[model samples]
Target: MKKLIQFYLFIIFSIPCFSQSFSFEWTKQLSSTYFAEYIWEIATDNDGNIYGATDGGGIQTFLDTTFDVATSASSTVLFKINDAGERKWLRHITNSENGSIAVDSNKKVYSGGWFIGSSSLPPYTLTAGAGFGNSSYYTTLDSLGNFTSATKVFSGNSFLNSIAPVICNEAGDVAYIDNREFPSGFTYIQYHTLTKKNSGGTSWTKAFTTTDVVPLYIDPANNLYIKGAYTSAITVGGTTLTNSGGQDIYVAKLDGAGIYKWVKKIGGNHDEWLQSAATDADGNLYISGYFNSDSIDLDGIKLYAELTENNSFVAKINAAGNYEWAINLDSNAYHFAMNLLVDEDGNKVLITGRYTEEMTLGTDILTVTPDQNIYVARLDLSGNILSGMQITFPLSATIYDRKLISPESMLICGTFSGSVAFGDSTYTSAGGDDGFITKINFCELPATYYADIDNDGYGTPDTFTTACNMPIGYTNNSSDCDDSNNAINPLALESCNTIDDNCDGNIDEGLIIATITPASATSFCKGESGILNANTGVGFSYQWKKNGVNISGATSSSYTATKTGNYSVLITIPGSCNDISDETSVTVYNKPNATITNIDATNDLCFDTSIKLKTGNGVGFTFQWYKGATALAGATSNIYFATTSGNYKVKTTNSFGCFKMSTPYTIIKTCKLGESDSPNLQVLIIVLVALKCQQPIQLLKIVNFGNQSL
Candidate 1:
């Protein structure tokens, strides 16, 4: 009987694998004759295209096309496939090891690895400087799998390049970190050489000291993170961190200009290797690996690994190099290679690795039958394991790469032998260990819902939870601005309340209250003007109105009323609210008529004679008399007397508080007593003036010498 992998086995031996919360959709097996080894790395572009880098020997069959490796050594093979598992094209790099692959935002593909001896990559051949060590090689290809640039090789004597881990930014700036081995004193030292090249062909390099380093991710901000294992103390960015016994794991971050941001270390008294890492959209880092130590310290929280067997662990770190949480699986088997990936939305973390014997994942115990030892787990951002499952291969299997695809699916590529079962479908290898790519999906995880307290078909955005079904008092909509009121939602009508009824960040929108200053009628003379002011607001447009019509060029908050009319203003907020102000009646009245006339019409009035001046209209008018420019005392009447005046006028005021001035009436001193004809006559004139003549005295003919009547 064939050996079986038992995941929480009960009494039955033919039971299905530990019930998984996920199911396999499809699996594609790449058959080969001479054993297509590891599927090193896998990447995807925005166009849903999947690219894989692998190593194989001799002839390999990809879809319907067979490709030759030419040499007997393991050569690098890069292939492209669509989202629907359709192979597009493949390239063979002879005599190269398993390489790394990355797809930039521009859909440009990058592939690199270390090659021994003379490796041929199409028209470009890279020859090693020496016949012993390895030299790094890198190349680029367009989205359609066509070569866009010449293959570049890096080789020198001081340092040796091993595996090339490459990445690129949106601006087509390419950067890679290659493992460099060199001799320091009598001992051989290993580190990483980080080379950055921009589109302008400007390039620079930086060195990091470690035992081995792997470049895992480059974020959208061009910040890169590298994970490695170091045995001794290493200084980065002026901070020195000493290893805590055995081989410790270190993660470091560098900006686009190759400046070290920070470096962190995690380890225990025994050995720990960080094998896989991933970054979220927020630049938070997630790493997974195996440790043979009894306990590993992650920033202050410790996880026990049990010295008897190797265990797998996962941890999360913030962008500022702060440890959030860490967790480990209780397993007695040796976890070798592992791959990790965070979902595109950064909600979930997926970890895939190979393990032997038995492993304890959370509350479930999974026991593998002999060689069937593949584990896949899903975890939340808080380091809580959601689900765990195992993929059983009768012979051998190693998952090297895992990616998250569209429509909530996981695409994993690896090498498996014998017959491997993926849910209901099983794939058998053609000869040796064949390369495989499988798409898996979660069954039905709980989804988050918000609370709808007012039953308004909308829910509060802040209060939410995850559940398998819609919880009572909860809904899928999260657009309710006020959950306590049913009328305050995204669909609610705006009113005069000081609140954002439509959840659009505006208060009382579309229900404008137009108001005017004074709020009363303005009274003025016909030729005079009165100012009418309306309410002012930011982003508000105004149009003044005379009665109910829009006044031309009256687009201001204040309007000038020149003529008698009902004045108003249209206040508007463009695309939002508008209103017309209450009518402000403006009464423009004509001035009261005041015409002065001389009653005693004479050619010239004598000095001692008086004249009466009357106004044209005296009813309902108050009059004032003026001599030249001086007002006569006690002249508040409809008529005035002119005794001896050069010019006289009357001012008439009506009940409407409007006053008018009549034209001036002139009077001349035509006749006068002889100044000094006789002293006695002058004395008589003086005596008459002293009497303050109450009545006008008719002047007789001038009598020279004593009072002679004329």
Candidate 2:
């Protein structure tokens, strides 16, 4: 018994023991030496260059495959990379102000946000002004790092927060979101503008507005979609939509003409806001945001049972303003949802936020944690958490935003203290709010499979194998039908003619099959037809039927149709069917003749209008209408018009006989008098009447007889 037990263990752990393993090594950092401060954002440009935004130190630019900084003196800069991820550039403005950046199709950058002062000078200084109380401004720049034009598009005492622009039309036009302060309170609205160039240079025209515009996205059709929260009444698509709770996320759709199509609000009684929105290649809209629910469970954590600031949730919304799925991220405490980025596959979403160390359970107990650590989590398209990874830096390090550099790479930017990894080397930031950038490259080593050859999970007594060739006892082992034939594997299924005989659920599935189906025998009015059908099973489906009745879905068979007017059936099936059987039909009826009759046109005999002739069952017959001796060249049987006062006749000929018929009809034309002739004709009639008077006519004077008539 002891020997048998040891032998069983060996068989279980043998497979995993031989599996290959790989290790990951960090690369060098890429940044400048000027005490990199808080890195707000990191992006790779079109030429594969790296660019990062600094909170106070401006922007840092990197070259191709180099960790050394190329340039590092851009103030209030927002870095951008093209869709190709090759080139990189920065939208820099002087005097450093808060703003958002967007790129158009032509590689032009449009930055809109609040600026401080005046809009003069080369770098455009923003000084104190009337609307300079943290008001918003919009500017445009060319691809060559030159300011094309700057415009103070919006101005107000209220803060213009969370601005996003999208290239909605091919004309390089953009639609954006802006929040304005009303007398009552602050209200978020959407605005759009188009650039036009006349003889006097370029100009902009204000298009339209929408309410609660936070997240803005434009589809390929130039349709604008916005999401945000509104308190008071706001008009969207010309209809006023109201929000119930204090703060709610509202989604509004607009047409290309700047007309609102529909507006939908999503949120509970508490504060809910959508942080990011994107459109897939299929034009499906996806949005991610935080929801404060009173009753919900997230990741096995209870939330919202009591009023607590820590209850926060993450959710995804579809294009139709419907929730795809919602996942509660924090149940005990408040977790802020910052930014959402989609990877290349577009099937996974990356959510970045800061979760406090404080926890609240049954009571409002706040743990005096030092700082909040930034957490980045990956989720599937369905809002299911795939992996939750957290990077905890010192309290001074503030991660502003992060983006996926590639499927396996990510770049994070924010404020950092001390020395932080940039590329290959560690870069120490200048204390007091410096910029910091970090790049993480993830290498997905090939999968290694370990089988329980010895029934043990440990590597002991187990053999490991590469995914390509799994060892025996593994799930993939069943793929090797003839283990002796090294070539006989899952990959070799195409070369074999047997059905996944390899147990891969694929039959000679990939192998081509030659099908041979004999042409179906033509059916006679009454006779036996010999039908021979054959197929090599290469790619074919055959079914033989007699008189439209399938012969039990038979692939190869013959049938006879004795009595029939027309008999036919189909053969070739799709997908697996390559050969098709010819459609055989036998006709037994001769052609029948049809004739027309009871034909009429216009009103009755009194009315002078075109008339028609009727015919009866006279097949293959031709007709000709005649007016007196001349035949109406354009006239045909069944209908003839009387152009003159005479009798109309129709002559028709068929295979049986020729027939002729006539109908009496009259034609009358109306005449009208001209203006000049009307006056003369009236005078002539009056003179003629005067001469035809039989009695001596006396000039009758107007007698004013009120009571008696004279």
Candidate 3:
């Protein structure tokens, strides 16, 4: 019988198993294209069309597989794309000197630039008017590549060195930096704006001005942030102005109403200009620029802030305009940082720059030999240099401009010394400093996967086969059954056998059972016992446990534990089968305690009061007084009463005890009809009266008993 029972348990524990898998590879490089003149910017539109802004080739458009240059003499070549990576476009301002490009959500391109010529066509005739003020224009383009409107946003006799435009809001309002000449002969940063209605009109409002020369950025809240170099000391908007050196990078934050919130100066004695600034999701500002630290440490670090003459520097500033970290890359004396691109993860920044090396002649004849190699470096968000790699192409001339096309690619536009080999073509320098364009693609390899099957970083030599069965003691990777145990093999179903058929260590581990008991039941109070029995498997040991601990000396088919607690039992067959039944638990709750006591109403009595109220004398007892169904405030003592006639009761509760109430008491207010009651009696009456009055009176007293005096 025991052997038969063991076999029955083995048949109950058997199941199936499965596995998981994966793989990868790389493709060849795609064909590349070349361009005439140096490229300043390469941006990809939503549809994957590549747009290259070249110095001499106007705007080069590579659309739908064709590489062609758009011949527009007025093209300044500023490119930007939408969030979806589609709708590639370039901003061009006619009759203007130099300009910058910005795009809005409506796909409208906003171009702000200086006008150099008087002619309305190509080679816009340059008019030598005021010192630096003849070229300033603003134009907007629609989605279909048509110029919706053009307006001379700002025109002055003073020279406008730089113009930066930004969309301030979704309402089509734009803000830009206008570097107007100050009366002190120093250029100052001025804010200008254009409304939605006057897209073509030459109407603009001068918002604000600062004693600095640089572009300003407008945030989502319509606040303005400006960064640039300042010379003379001038106070603007209550902020004290101070310069670091010849030209130090200065930042100013303004409110929506063009009011200055704070101004910050960063850098040392050397010339430091903030080239670009970006804000993170947390509003922390990141500014990058070239710092020539010759005498002072802008960021306090000699390597990062000190002027190394030729090395370039990048620094990160937090939202409060405080320097967080900084790093210096390379020792090339003529290295210039052009642009910074953040990776998709936003944790790393890619910086692109041009490195130039100078060559020396005889004793006193030192010539500047320019290597003009393109260098790119990846840096952590904290400004720590990661992988700094440079790719130098031997060109006959210098590389004047370059821009990043993608996180892994860049378009280098510069005047090559001679014909240069690009992707699949060669770009020849147009005679005297001809413009050249080339695309550089950097490929990243896939990461390898590793699995530690033996609990080590390395793997072991384990043979895998297609067989469905294997010899005893050997695991067949494909089968979930244990061949070593006849009772646990897949052939067994459910006959109460006891064995690990699935190769697992335990017997009947995965078996299931059902149990039923009285849904609603009761048990005795404290110090009393009750019986709890389960209708389960036979021959079970019935070792009862409570709250996960074994109940000493309590072993029976049913447990009679006196104390209340969670109870469970384990059943063991104790035979060749050695099958252990699953443990089941039941919770036992202790009954509430009960007690009774009486209250002394004599000394605590009120005027005209009768009947007695009481409380329990139980330990940990607390009392509460109720008058006509309403509990009285501060009445939680062992005794309680009222002077007037009304239903009164005393409630008492203790630890492990249920709340109990005393019999209701009745009190009546009465006074002598005629006689001036005895002095002693009157005194007692007055004291009781005060006690009754002390009872917190409800706002609306239902009855007003007649007042009497002795």
TM-score of each: 0.53, 0.44, 0.44
TM-score of 2: 0.44
Candidate 2 lDDT, 1-710, residue by residue in tens: 00000000000000111111211112222244442433443434334444443323323433233222223332355554443334354444544344445454555656654445553325665443464244455666666667776666555554332233322333455665444433334553444333222112433333334333443565666666666566655665566656556565566676556556666665455566666655555555555555665653322333352444534455555556555566665465566666665543546666666667553322223343454454556666766765554444446555555555444445555555566543224555443345545544333344455443432222221445543322334442333444444444555545444445343666555344333343554332223333444443334455655455665645543344344423333444344423334445543332222333335554243344444444443566677766666778876655554544455556665543434444534343332222334332321112123366687668733322232222
Q: For residues 1-710, what per-residue lDDT tens digits would candidate 1 score against the true structure? A: 01111111000011112333454556677777775556767787778788888777767776667877753677878888887777898887777775777787788888888776788776677887763466788888888777666554667663456546676656677777666566778876776777777655777777776455666566667677777677888776676778899988888888877788888888888788776666788889888877888888988988875444578888899989899998886545566436676765548877767777666666666667665566767677888876666655435556666676654455777788888876566777777778877766543464677999999889998898664335557898798888999988998888765689998888876677788884334887767778888888778899888879989999988887878888888888756567888898888878998887667767266643777777766457788889899999998877777777488888888877788888888877745554665456552243244656688778745543555653
- Clashing residue pairs for model 1: 4-369, 5-369
Candidate 2's displacement at residue 686, Å, is 99
Q: Which regions in candidate 1 have their CA more than 4 angstroms from the true location?
A: 1-38, 71-74, 116-118, 156-161, 168-174, 180-191, 198-203, 306-308, 329-337, 343-380, 384-395, 416-433, 441-710
Q: Given candidate 1, what's the lDDT at residue 179?
A: 68
Off by over 4 Å in 3: 1-96, 116-133, 156-175, 179-212, 216-224, 255-257, 295-307, 330-334, 342-346, 356-371, 393-402, 414-418, 429-437, 446-710
- lDDT score at residue 660, model 3, on the 0-100 scale: 60
The weakest ten consecutive residues by lDDT in model 1 span 3-12
Model 3 poorest ten-residue lDDT run = 1-10
